[model samples]
Every structure is written in structure tokens, then in C-alpha cells.
Target: MNARKTWTRTLGTATAAGALAWAVVAAGQPSAAPTSEPVAETGPGYAIEDYNYPGADRILAEQGIVLKRGDGHIVLADCLSEENLLRFLARGRADVCFKVTADEGFLTLEIPSVHGVRTDDSVNTHLAMTAEDDRVEYDIPAKTWEGVGESVDGREHVLVEIRVTK
Candidate 1:
């Protein structure tokens, strides 16, 4: 079971975007809300969906990707897996980081933790990007990031898909 869990999380940062397109898998979850909001900006883009946090809190926490600034610490999971992450991006300015482990002994795979760039508007109602360049500042709205994964029991699976809008 350890191998399975490892591979699952591994697909997170790597293939964070590309692989998600080709496969249909159920992701884990995220972390809980801050009970409030962070009061500083560091990375570039970030915010907090306070009201909705409790609903999807488990998903983010399980993902385990946290960032901090001063007396404030915000998890990237706190922003992702939502309809509107722009608020968090604008406020948190989080530098996205992700990690997903896999059972290396079972499968051999090549997934990018930082998949190039693509126009992903499949999730109707969410125009993640109006264009493909400088996602922050809402200029080009090009999103970029990466993921990590591994092979296990002869099957390739996903761990996480870390995406940053910048």
C-alpha cells in the first residue's frame, strides 16, 4: 500500500497539467482554511476563499503544499481545486510547490513536474486564462507549473498537479 500511496502523490507536481488531460483519475483532497486570511504578498498572486474552505478543506490538507509569509502561512492547496483562485493569487502571492511520489519499482514513466504551456479551458465557466502569457496581473493570463508521478504495479498513476497562475 505504501507504494501505491507514493505513486499517487508523486503525480502531483509532475505531469501536474499534461497527464491530467489524458487520464481520468480521482484526486485526493486539499487543506483546511486559515480561519481568516493571510495579510501579506510574496510570491506574486494569491488569495483565500474563506467561506468555501471548510467544504474542500480535507483535499488541500492531504495534498500537503504550504507556503508562508511573516506571521502568515498559506497552503497552495488553499488556492487550487477551486473555481476562483485569482483572489488567493492576488493576495497570497504564493510560489507554488508540489510533490507526488510513486512506486518506482513497478512502472517506468516520464512525467514533467513543469509541463510546458497549454490553453486548458475544458472546465466550462472557468476561463483560467484569457491568453497564454503572464497569467498574473491579468495581462496574458498564462498559467504554468509542474507535477510528479511514478510507476507502480505496472500501472502509471497521478499524485498531484501543481499549477500556478503567473
Candidate 2:
């Protein structure tokens, strides 16, 4: 008699649990709602990273600097904005400066007739430029101004890339 009662209780509990699970699953299923409009399929698009410089067209128009792309650690800045800036000199134009926020940085740009680069106090800088069909590179020490590009060879060189390490 005790065994029969135990079996009966177990069967009842199992049936209740099964019914509860079925109710939960059925509740999750889609049902007809009182809507007259069709569902739209549109949504916000995905985000993508292209690495192109922001406001590049505006800066090119305003400053004549052809900024291409970078890792965002190095950026164009006002020459007089702060000290310890990476300064660049180009012929037929004013000196350009950049601010470095990290221990390492990279920027690719085009500045025609670049002849000199001044490194900040914290980073050793490497510069790459091109003149006609030849490529030129310079390694500049921290807190030093080094003549690069056309200053060394008299050929007009376009500054292409700047890499710095602390």
C-alpha cells in the first residue's frame, strides 16, 4: 500500500512537470497578434572599420595635407598647440606638426617636398618618402631635428609615412 502511494505521487509529479514544460514551450511559440501592418525587414546597418583618416577631405582642403590612414595613435596637430610635438617641414609651405599620444604610433600621409623632421622627446622616429621613382628613409632620434627627403639629395621627395617608437 505504501509502495502504491509512492508510485502514485511520483506519477502525479511527473505529469505536472510535463504539463508545466509544455506550457512554457507553448508560450514561447509565436501566436497571432492583432496587427494590421506588415513587419518591416529594415534595420540599422553593420559597422565597419576602414582605417581612413577622419575629416580627411576637409583637412586637405584647409591645410593641404593629404592624410590617408593610420592607427589613430598619431594625429595632426597645431604647431603652437603644445611642446614635444613631431614637427615636419616642407618646401613652399609652412611647417606641420603632429601629436603623439602613445609609445608607438604610425601615420601615412603625403606632404610634397618634405625636407626635415623634428622628433619629440619621447620617441624615436622613422620616416619614409619618395622622390620620382626612388625611395628614401630616415631614422631620427628623440628631441632632434634631422634633414630628410629633399634636404639630403636635392630631389623633391614626398613624405609618405611616419613611424615612431618610444
TM-score of 1: 0.17
- The lDDT values for all models are 0.28, 0.92
What tens-digit string does per-residue lDDT give for candidate 2 at 61-80? Answer: 99999999998988999999
Model 1: which ten-residue window has the lowest total lDDT?
102-111
How well does candidate 2 match the true structure in TM-score terms? 0.73
Best-matching candidate per lDDT: 2
- What residue pairs clash in candidate 2, if any at all? none
Candidate 1 deviation (Cα RMSD): 35.2
All candidates: TM-score:
0.17, 0.73
lDDT of 1 by residue, 16-83 (tens): 77677545443434546467545554455666544222323443465432222211121222335553
